[model samples]
Target: MIPDATLAALFAAAVAARENAHAPYSRFHVGAAVLSESGAIHAGCNVEVASFPEGWCAETTAIGKLVSAGEKSIRAVVVVAEGDRLTTPCGGCRQRLAEFAAPDTPVHVGGPDGIRRVFTVGELLPASFELEEQP
Candidate 1:
């Protein structure tokens, strides 16, 4: 579990990022924030393209920022979306996050009403597919 203050900050960042989302098609703006191992917070908003399936999720964008900043590990992550209901990361984003976050990393979901739920990466994606050396 992460500190309450840190989690609050993550949630705030995600909410703020959602304002910049370019989701004209779906009109479902989403934002995500990643807390790196070094305690740096990175944020991103969803970007939608005219071509379906070419859109980028907020979580993926935030993870990209984390990697661009030279961080290889994520300690925690939060996602926020429009409306009163919380929004969790999609399956693809969950898998992408697994690449940099431990299975026990905290994943917070929130909405305008604030954090609605929290779960570990493993809980969100049980038995995640991972590559291992097969000697």
Candidate 2:
């Protein structure tokens, strides 16, 4: 679990990233920030394209950037949004999170309502996880 201080940092980063969201269709801007085991932070904003299928969610972008940079794991992650209600990771992002985060890994969500809730990656996506067994 990340200390509260780290959570604050990620929260701020997520909020900052939200400003860069490229949503025109839904206009539901969202941001995600992830802390990698290597002590680096990655940020992503949900980008919506006219060809919808080409769009990428903020969580996947952050995780992909971290992994492409050679980070094998993430310590924790925070998500932010501008919705009236608490924003949760979409199913795609949740499944992507399970690939890099262990069941106990922490997921924090926040917005105008404040730090609304925290859940584990496993709790966020509890079914049909595609995890490989370790020796």
Please report, in order, the local distance difference test score of every candidate based on alpha carbons.
0.91, 0.85
lDDT per residue as tens, model 2, 3-51: 7788788888888888899999999889899999877888889999999
- Name the top lDDT candidate: 1
TM-score of 2: 0.90
TM-score of each: 0.94, 0.90
Query: Candidate 2 — which residues are off by over 4 angstroms?
Result: 131-135
Tell me each candidate's RMSD, in Å, in order: 1.6, 1.8
Name the top TM-score candidate: 1
Report the lDDT of model 2 for residue 6: 81
Tens-digit lDDT string for candidate 1 (8-99): 89988998999999999999999999999899999999999999889999999999999999999999999999887658899999999889
Worst ten in a row by lDDT for model 2 = 124-133
